[model samples]
Target: MSESVAGREAGSGIPARRLWLATTLILLIFVLLLAAYLLLRKPTEVTVPAPVAAVPAPDPAFATRVRQLEELNRSLEAEIARLGRDPSPLACPPGTARRAEARPPQTPAIA
Candidate 1:
């Protein structure tokens, strides 16, 4: 019984030593594979776009049209202001005048 116990204590250290060696070998293989992948990987490329040119000035004809529209807008605003002050109803058109004589009220006819 004493020899068997002694043999177990002696053999216990051999399995612990084998486990430590296996763990170290696995770690070394993982590190070598990671280093090889990083070394063989291709670098990314970046492209730069060209700068845009400055915008050209507006045309003279467009400037003249804009000024004419602004003047017309001012005149219409003045006419609206004059109408607001007077508050007069607009004149009826020539063809749609109301009749001068009032018609007598007609009672409903008997059936």
Candidate 2:
């Protein structure tokens, strides 16, 4: 096997290792040139305006709901004041599970 391997060399005194080194250097040079070209290319930059702040108007339905709530609140206060005279009968939201005297927790109990 050694005798056959000896003839594998060109006998130019240059080793097979030198061929591998030359191939590596050639590839390295090509990579460097590609990287240099990419680095030197012009780059673009963009500027965008900051968004303006604006006051938001209440939604139509929301405004209507607010008015309805105010009316309902006033009516409720009046009813309470009227009912304040007689403590016997009570009023409650329709479909409430319990009796009117059994007032549901409006402001949650402080823990």
Instruction: Point to the candidate with the largest TM-score.
Output: 1
lDDT of each: 0.92, 0.84
User: Which pairs in model 1 have colliding backbones?
Assistant: none
- lDDT string for model 2 (6-93, tens) is 8665564476678989999999999999999899988888899999999798799999999999999999999999888876555555
Scored against the true structure, residue 101 in model 2 reaches a CA lDDT of 80
Best by lDDT: 1
Q: What is the TM-score of each candidate against the true structure?
A: 0.39, 0.34
Alpha carbon deviation, residue 61, candidate 1 (Å): 28
- Residue 31 lDDT in candidate 1: 100
Off by over 4 Å in 2: 1-15, 45-59, 66-111
| Clashing residue pairs, backbone N/CA/C < 3 A, model 2 | none
